[model samples]
Target chain A: QQPVQSPQAVILREGEDAVINCSSSKALYSVHWYRQKHGEAPVFLMILLKGGEQKGHDKISASFNEKKQQSSLYLTASQLSYSGTYFCGTEESTSYGKLTFGQGTILTVHP
Target chain B: DAGITQSPRHKVTETGTPVTLRCHQTENHRYMYWYRQDPGHGLRLIHYSYGVKDTDKGEVSDGYSVSRSKTEDFLLTLESATSSQTSVYFCAISDSEGLYSNQPQHFGDGTRLSIL
Candidate 1:
């Protein structure tokens, strides 16, 4: 099943903070995040593993709650460069490398 | 940035014609995936290959078939194109697995296919 992302879209000013949430129906082994610009492929942001491990971009941080089967991406001191569509992909315990991505959250940071 | 390249960056074909999209990667990642991006639907996985000749279907595998004859190349074929299949297709590769599940995926530039 695909994960659900809240706040379909958000607008923020430079230096502001925003949080995007993602939830899944099934138990997740890990949650992956990616950012996609208007005309480019989705770029890797971070990956939150079930057992409390994180990897990827330094500017953004995320958390995965294994108990709730949910994850959240936190953007602190947001910059104009953060403007893009953020996606959260969930991996179930049974689905090895496969991921089911959320609908996506559009974050637009203004100058 | 993973040395991944998707061929025919843009394509426009009519219905009923067979179309094939190719993804070539130089990273030698064990896992390769094919996803379709549509407005409001985000990216839906169609198929993924764990290794050469090791392929599996994803949630939205209908109307799509895939083949991985070698390590570097994965092919997605639309036996008979349909209007609904027209969307931006992305190819992603990841080295994540049992011991390295934290590895993030890297994507190709993507192919914008338009089936008219």
Candidate 2:
């Protein structure tokens, strides 16, 4: 099943922070995050496995809670380049590599 | 970006016609997937291939078929294109060695298809 993302859209000023959450009804083995700019391919951000580990790169970070089937993406001190549609993909334990992505959260960072 | 290429980046076809989108990857990944992106519905999996000649259906596979004759090429076909099938198609690849492996999927630029 597809995951659910909160705050369908968010607008933030440069240097502001925002959080995007993804939750699934079924158990998840891993959560994957991607950012897509207009007319561009989705770019991989990070992936959190079932061990409750938090991973980050630069000012972007993500956390996965297998027990709650929830994952959150954090953007700190947002930049203009961070304006894009954020998507979270979830993989179930039984699924090999099939990922069901959420509806997406549009993040707009203004100057 | 991954070494994935999708041919005919943009296409327009009439209803009932057959359409095929090609996905070629140089990464030699073990798994490949086809997905369609529509407004309000992020991305839905259409089909996936685990290896050459090994493929399976996904969440939305009713009017689609896939083939993986070689490790580097995966093809997605719309048996009979319809207006509802008009959307952006993306081909993703993953290097997961096994079913339980945790690996990130890299996506292609995507093919924009319009059916009238």
Candidate 3:
């Protein structure tokens, strides 16, 4: 099943903070965050494995809550470069590589 | 980048015609996936393969088929194209069963296919 993402879209100013959440109906083994610019392939951001691990890249970080079957992507001190659509993909308990992606969250950061 | 390439970056074909999009990777990764992106759907998985000749359907598998005959190539075919299938298709690969299950998938530039 495709995960559910909160705040379909958000607008922020530089140096602001924003959070995007993804939840799944089934147990998840891992959660991945990616950013896609207009008309481009999604770029990897970070991956949070099961067992409550937290992962981050640059100013972007994510946490996975096995109990809730959810994950959240945190953008700290957001920059204009962070403007893009963010998607979260999840791996179900039984599948290894198969991923179901959320509808996506559009984050717009302005000056 | 993972050295992934998708053929015919842009294509426009009539309805009811058979169209095949090719995804080639030099990384020899064991996992390959095909996904379609639409306005509100984000990216929906059409199919994926764990190994050569081992493929499986995904949530949006209807009207779409996939093949992985070799380690370097995966193909997604539309038996009969339709206007509903017009969207951007992406091919991705991962080296470690995808970042511990939800591993980061390295995506190709994507194929823009339009059914008229």
Candidate 4:
């Protein structure tokens, strides 16, 4: 099944903070996060395993809650470069190699 | 763009015509995928490949087919294009499963297709 993303769209000023959440109705084996700017392909951001791993950068981070079947992407001190849509794709243990993506969250960061 | 290239960045075709999109990768990743992106719906997987001649269907596999003749190239074909099939397509590769499943996927620029 497709994952659900909350806060369909949000506008923020530079240096602000924003969080995007993704939840799945069924159990998830892993979660993948990606970002896409206008007219560009979706770029990989990070991946979270069922073991609750949070791979992140200096400003961007993500957490996976295996029990809740949910994941969250956190953009702290957002920059203009963070303006784009974020998508979360989930992999079910039973369905390997296939990922079910969320509807996406549009985030706009202005300087 | 990690060494991945998608041909015909933009295309406009008519219904009932055959359309084939090509994805070429230099990364030599073990896994590859084809997905479609629309306004409201996020990227939806159409097909994917694990190795040469090894392909599988995805969630939105209907009306579409795929072929991986070589390790570096995966192709997505629309047997007969329809207006409903008009959308931007993306191809992604990952060093996933068969090798490592936790790796993130790298993507190509994408193909913008429109059916008239």
What is the C-alpha local distance difference test score of each model?
0.93, 0.91, 0.90, 0.90
Model 4 lDDT per residue over B1-116, tens place: 47999998999999999999999999888899999998899999999988999888998999999999898999999999999999999999988755335788888999999999
lDDT of 1 by residue, B1-116 (tens): 69999998999999999999999999989999999999999999999998899999998899999999999999999999999999999999988766334688899999999999
Error of 1 at B3 (Å): 0.4
Task: Give lDDT tens digits, candidate 3, residues B1-116.
Answer: 58999998999999999999999999988888999999988899899988899898898999999998899999999999999999999999988743345456899999999999
Count backbone overlaps in model 3. Answer: 2
Q: What is the TM-score of chain B alone in each candidate?
A: 0.96, 0.97, 0.95, 0.95
lDDT of 2 by residue, B34-106 (tens): 9999999999999999999999999999999999999999999998999999999999998876684377788
Docking class of 2: medium
**Per-chain TM-score of candidate 3, chain B:** 0.95
Error of 4 at B75 (Å): 0.7
Q: Please, what are the lDDT tens digits per residue for candidate 3 over residues A37-91?
A: 9998999999888776655576677778899998889899999999999999998
Candidate 1 local distance difference test against the native: 0.93
Candidate order by decreasing DockQ:
2, 1, 4, 3
Q: Candidate 3 docking: what grade?
A: medium
| Candidate 2 chain A: worst-modelled 10 consecutive residues by lDDT | A51-60
Residue A6 accuracy (lDDT) in model 3: 92
Write down the TM-score of model 4's second chain.
0.95
Q: List, residue by residue over A1-111, the lDDT tens digit for candidate 2.
A: 889999999999999999999999998888999999999889888888887654436567887877889988989999999999999999898887889899999999999
